[model samples]
Target: MPFALYLLGLAVFAQGTSEFMLSGLGPEIAAEMGVSLAAAGALTSAFAVGMVVGAPLMAALSLRWSRRGALLGFLGVFLAVHVVGAVTGSFTVLLVSRAVGALANAGFLAVALATATGMVASDAKGRATSALLGGVTLACIVGVPAGAVIGQLWGWRAAFWAVALLSLPAFAGILHSVPKGAAGGPGVRGELAALRSGRLRLTLLWGALVNGATFCTFTYLAPLATEVAGLGTGGVPVVLALFGVGSFVGVAMGGRIADVRPVPLLVGGGVALCAGWVLFALAAGEPAVALVLVLVQGALSFGVGSTLISQALYAAPGAPALAGGFATAAFNVGAALGPWAGGVAIGAGLGFRSPPVVSAGLVAIALVTAGMGRRVWRERVGSVSTGAQDK
Candidate 1:
């Protein structure tokens, strides 16, 4: 991988810290802003909504712009918003800043994905994608916990300030490393036309379903660890860290082979994920078992999820810029829906373990979708071959 890809990953780490750190600071934010806890939590929802909307919108808007220029512009916006969020007195201002920051984050991620793959060999796209995504796993492991600690020690505002400061190096690196005038795609019209491909559509659906399954359980893991597994509050972070470790390993290992053996890896990982979730739900009362399952589940979730994302990019060859945006939108759709489904289950008296069960069902559906995607891929390839023969 190019050093530039590592810089992109570093940028993602800074953005991802802002994205996930809010989870730990919700209560502090609520107290400081004189709002309900739910309202503070809504900040996260606002970010998710922004990401879902911004990915495609920003990608299209910047499709013809210099890649380096777009990346620097987004990072500048992200840094400015965090500063605004840190200084804002009104809760409304903070909330709006978070959403705007997410718009920039989403745009950066989309462009970074296209940029990372472009820097690598065609056969190594999966590895390039994983290299970029590794920053997210690292943020989950190091950045979020560090941000939480910073918030707990100083104040929530300090955490926001930290995110702003952390992004400075990334902005500098991108400006230095990324080539000037490297526009993303052929054009907006060409990208839009590529969206009509059946393979691309199914792959995007696969990405959504796989991610929905992962987050449905992951979003509620803390409660499940404490209530069902009999762990104390102190143990919750341990479980989360363990999951992050497993995810890092998964991405590192799976990236090596995902491009070469996408079908087997996808099918195998999905099946394992479904079974792992089912087992997790059944063994929720065992503290030791729950801990181990969390790690395994994280590995399976990210391994398959990353592969699906890489496949989406491969599926949309004609839409280099839009492909990353579509993949971003797909994953965020699941990120939003998965937690909602989990919340609905718990709200309806299904209990903490229900989320894992729900995840299993989601994975099963993903498996079926993967099968349909395989057929579509085959048909598309066959038709192209037939057209060539006729010519």
Candidate 2:
């Protein structure tokens, strides 16, 4: 609702665009570089691995700087990396660019999320977080299409050039929107303590599993659609776009629901997510059903975005930045693992349908984990409340 929110959202849009652009450009890069598709796909995976490595590293480094400076610095790095990607003809050079870009991009998002949480009221945190992540949802729908077209029309190199150009706007937006003195205080010790706590550990584990299920299915959807669902090349992007639309809608609803009952919403969403995957496995055999199920799965999978974020923040109120960073890192770890595992399943002659079923099973695990997590968190909160009332 605030103007700062819009600028932050734009920054996220740019980041999301840059993060996902590789997926669309993978085949082009593979063909251009005379590498196999598997190797080209590794370009995308490299980014996720970078995120896992970069999130904590940059979060630690950023303790010395203001949030504004940290955000700006990362964006600058992101811009430069894209430029490098554009100019590099060597596959190794492109890999370096992607890795650097991924690292900077992860830090940028971690800081942006920490900044966003501080900008809003305690009650509006979930909604604010949702609005921020909604940019990513939009990017998946719009930015991917734009990147695909650019890669198709000019060159994949040109697509990277376009992303590089966006860093200028992202820098300008962050400088303009984020207040000069709005930086949060450092809490490296507190964050470490929180991470060591059982509650936080459980939450992260649940988040990782849930994320793995969702991303695994999504990462391979394009190939799966073509090989298993019998969808044509033209239809794959449409399905991906439809999935993005579902994500946008889910995040909006998740934001509102989280404000009322964050824990329950998370648990319910996990259940729905698992159900969506099951539906996907069954529906993949039917073109119409597959389309509908993909959209449903998208919404169900992403519906808990704000809730999961809010849960992590609440779990570690003393270390919001670290919590945010940890959540981001855990998510990417899932993203990395999901596709790799799905690829293995496909390579094993299980067929494309096997991955979605496997993903559903993972979601089912997350559902059970969410239930236990909610119970534990609720009991702890209740105990604290009782102690306060007695005192």
Candidate 3:
């Protein structure tokens, strides 16, 4: 990777750390704030809602500033929010701080994706995007585990302090590293035009379905490890670590596979994800099988990100900003829906493993959609070729 890309990755790492570290500290936060685990979990939901609202709002508003400036501004906002979160005494205040942090995060990620991809050659776009997103995957590997340890050793408040401290250097890195590119507002009309495209719609659908499925399984992963897999609280960290490792591997492989064959890679990811979910649902009663299935599911599902983003860019050729924003929105939409859906199943006495079962069903539907998209692409190409032959 280039020097600038490396710096951007660092920023991404910090952002990822701040965002995902919440999962590891959930129990500690609940206890510290004198709230229920479910209430603490709502912080995650609030973050997703902020992303859904902020991505486009920031993208559209940032048109006047250079991408570099936009990134820097967003990071500043992120830092402020984290600082507030760390210092606040009230649970409501903390919740608001996290929500604001999420809102800032939307712009940070959007600008990062747009900038990193722009730095590379056209053919390397997938790799570039993956490299940036890989930082997020890596957070699961490093930051989440580390945060959990911090919370266990020090306190949940200390974990937020750690996030804030870590973010400072990342903020500095962005100020020094990322370069400015494309400085014009893609007004509401331009953003709307990109959304109107059929390919973009398919991209959004693919993102939402795949991410929702993944989150449904992941949100209740701890419960599955405990209730179904017969693991103790001590085992939760280990299971999460294994899943993170799988996600890291998946992100790397997804980059390579997307470069080779974008659509086919997506199809393959969908297949693997469905298989993993099936395995999880059936074998969750066995500790060993559940552990293995979690890793596999993480690997397969998160790996599809490259294909989904690539499809969005291909579908909306000239408007990357809008595509970036919408793709992110789709991701958050899934993120918001997945946990709730899984929680409902769990409440209904289906057990924690039920999420994986339902997620698998959703992925199966996505597979059919992917096949339909492939057919449409082929027919369109054939018609154009036939028309040209007549000419």
Candidate 4:
């Protein structure tokens, strides 16, 4: 909608790069830090855990800060942590830095979503959320790969440095453009009280489940392509690129349809996401087919993701700030859990394809959750209208 919303998206790109670039930098960090790759992988896990808890923690802690101030505060922490990480030689310190950085990233994103939504008409929430999330998609397409290359050419620290440098412009843009919008919804007590809503909780669960579905399959995508689809290591990025392309397409289309038909987008996208995973697993041996499925799966993933964000804002229209933070924490919880679940399946000899099966179940849950929430929400609204008419 506004130029500031685009600025928020760019800020998202800066933070999101760190979220994914570490996936490709594990080996380098492991070697440099003299830790096992498993321990290095734990650094990524710490970031996810921080993100999973960050927003709620911030919402509870910083109930009085202006949206613009909160955004800048998070970015400042993120930038400083990245700089510290870039210069650090201690593995443990790096781990701590990653966690703090993720916390800041989560806070920034939650506020950004709330602020963006507040800027637009109620009907345009989807487009606003999508616009902000487009940063993550662009990072998937560009930043993560570029960071991988930077890591290989220079070092993992160099990638962190690059991210830190990028944060400068994002911080300036946010500071210059983002208004000090009044916080939406309730304060700390209000957020806690609002959590009691079954409908709100259901929406949060749906957010988590949908993300879990995507990550469950996505965690094993590289192995699936190499072992089952018969692709070389180099081809892995190509598959990821295809997924990114689909994400871009999905988010763009979802932005257009979300305000007009949020339920259908969530329902149909969730269903399509499940089917895509099933077909992907079945076509694991067919490289072309698997590649095509990657694109479709990516599209469905973001289409559903955008809908969840839109629904979160609409469902808790009174408390955009708190609802936004809570929704983010919910999604990241799923993001953290999905990979763990997939790893469990693979560990049990279910193979790479098993991940998609696991993901399919998650999507099914999300679909059911959405259906239940929609029904309950509609009934609640109808009751309110009936009460008003009687009065």
Candidate 5:
């Protein structure tokens, strides 16, 4: 793997920290800005919405630009926006800054995905992608917690400043490592044409469903740990950290083998994830069991989830940039829908355990989708081979 790939991952780590640290600083932000908690939470929603919308749009717009230019521009925007967010006193300003920062983050991620895979052999796309995405898992383990601690000690604004500061190293590294005049994409039109493929569409759906199931349980893990598993508030962080560690392990292991055995990783990981969720639901009352299951769930969720992007890239050979954007959009869609589904289940009085059940259903649907996608892929390959033989 190229050292540039790890630098890109470092950039992702900075962006991801900003993305997730908001959760812990919500109360401080609300109080400081004199807004309701719900309003503060909307800041996160704004970021998510930006990420979903910005990925493909930015990828298309930047298709003609050099890859190095696009990445540096996005990182600069991200760094500037965080600085604005840090200094802004108005909640509206902060909200807008968060959204804009997310736009930059999404664009950077899309380009980085393309750039990373381009640097590797065709067979090692999965490993390259996992190397890039490992940043997010690292953020979950280190950055978010550190941000929370910073916010607790200083203020929410300090966390924003910290993100800005973190971004500086990434910006410098990307500037030094990524070559000048690196091509962005084939063209916007070619990218759009690639999106019409049925196999690509199914691959995106698979990504969304798998990510949705993962986030569904993750979003509600805190409540389940406390109300159901009888853990204190202090234990919640421990549980989350454990999950983060497991996810890191999963991504690392998956990266090593995913390119070689994509099907087994997805199918086996999906089945194990479903079973893990079911067991988590059943064992929610047992604190020890629940904690152990969270770790297992994280491993299964990420191990499978990490492959979807590589699959998307493979399915859309003509649109590497847009494929990265599509993968980003799919994961965000899942991230949004998963929590919403879990929320609905909880609101319906299904209890905290209901989220895991909902997750199980989502995983099952994802597995079925994966199966259908596999058939589609095989058919496409067969038809192409037949045409070649006739020629």
Candidate 6:
């Protein structure tokens, strides 16, 4: 792997920490803001929404500059947004800070992907992507829980400061380490042309559904650990850490098969996820079973994430740069939807475990959607073959 890739991973780790740290801070934020827990939960939704909007918008905007410069600009915006967040005592300001910070975070992530692939040799692209993704998974495994502990001991505002501190070096690294010639492409108009493809749209939908299925349950893991699984407060962090480990494992495992067997892998991932979540709901009363299910669920869900993304890109009929933007936005839109809907389920007295069941249902729906797309693909293939024979 290139040295620059590692620097990019470090940047990813910092940004991911900021993005997911909110998960552990949910209840604390609710109490501090004097709002319903559901309201504070919306903080996650707000960030997700920002990513949904920001990824494409920022990617489009970055086309005017070198990819390295674009990434640096976004990182600066990311750091500056956190400064406002760190200083704010108001709930409204906090929410706004999260959303704005996420916009910068989204743009940074979009360009960072471009830069990572550009930084490395062709054969090293896979390793580079894995490292960038690993940083994110490692952040989840380590950073979010640590941020939770920070919130538990000092205050949530302090967590923002920590993210800012982490981001500074990443900014400096991009400035110094990322060489010139990291140029942009044909821009958003080319990407928008992908809208003409029905298949690509479905693929993007698949991306959203996969992320929705994951976030629906994962978002409320803190409450589920305490309320449903009957873990003590201390155990909440332990379970979360384990979940992150599972995610890391999944990311590693997913990369292996994502290219060779994308459809089957996608189907298998969906089935495994649905089964895991259903089993989790059924076995919620058993602490040991619940814990195992939690970890395995993470693996099954994310293990094919890269493949699904690659598939989306392969299917896309637009600019390659926008391919990532499309896939990312799809997931974040689902990310936004998952928590908002989970909050609704909780508000309806469905309880924390209900979200997994909801996730299962969403996965099932995604599977059906996949089946439909597959059938269409086969028919298209058949039509082309028959036309060739006639010719």
- Residue by residue across 241-325, what tens digits does model 5's lDDT show? 9899999888888888777777778788989999889899999999889888988888888888888788778777678899999
Model 4: weakest 10-residue lDDT segment is: 382-391
TM-score of each: 0.96, 0.91, 0.90, 0.94, 0.96, 0.86
Q: What are the per-residue Cα lDDT tens digits for candidate 4 across 47-131?
A: 9888888887775555678888888888899999999999999998999999999989888888888789888976678888899
Clashes of each: 0, 0, 0, 2, 0, 0
C-alpha RMSD values across all candidates: 3.1, 3.2, 3.9, 3.2, 3.0, 4.7
**1-391: candidate 6 lDDT, tens digit per residue:** 6787788888889888888888778888788779999999888878878989988788778878888888888888889888888787788988888888888888777777666655654323334456677778889888887888898899888898998999888888888888877767666676566545566677788778878888888888888888888987887777777788888888777766554455567777888888888998888768898889888987877775655665544454244456667667888888878877788899999888899888888888888888877754322222212221121
- For model 6 the local lDDT of residue 86 reads 79
Of candidate 1, the 10-residue stretch with the lowest lDDT total is: 382-391
Question: lDDT (0-100) at residue 278 of candidate 4?
Answer: 86
Better of 1 and 6 by lDDT: 1
**After TM-score superposition, what is the CA distance of residue 237 in candidate 2 from its true location, in Å?**
1.7
Candidate 1 wrong stretches, greater than 4 Å:
379-391
Better of 2 and 5 by lDDT: 5
Q: How close is candidate 6 to the true structure, as a TM-score?
A: 0.86
Tens-place lDDT per residue, model 1, 142-215, is: 99999999999999999999999999998998898999968778789988987777877887887888789889
Candidate 4 stretches greater than 4 Å from native: 180-186, 372-374, 379-391
Tens-place lDDT per residue, model 2, 73-113, is: 88898889888888878898888888988888888777777
- Candidate 2 structure lDDT: 0.77
Task: Pick out the ten consecutive residues of candidate 5 with the lowest summed lDDT.
Answer: 382-391
lDDT of 3 by residue, 37-88 (tens): 9999989878888899988787677656788888888888888888788778
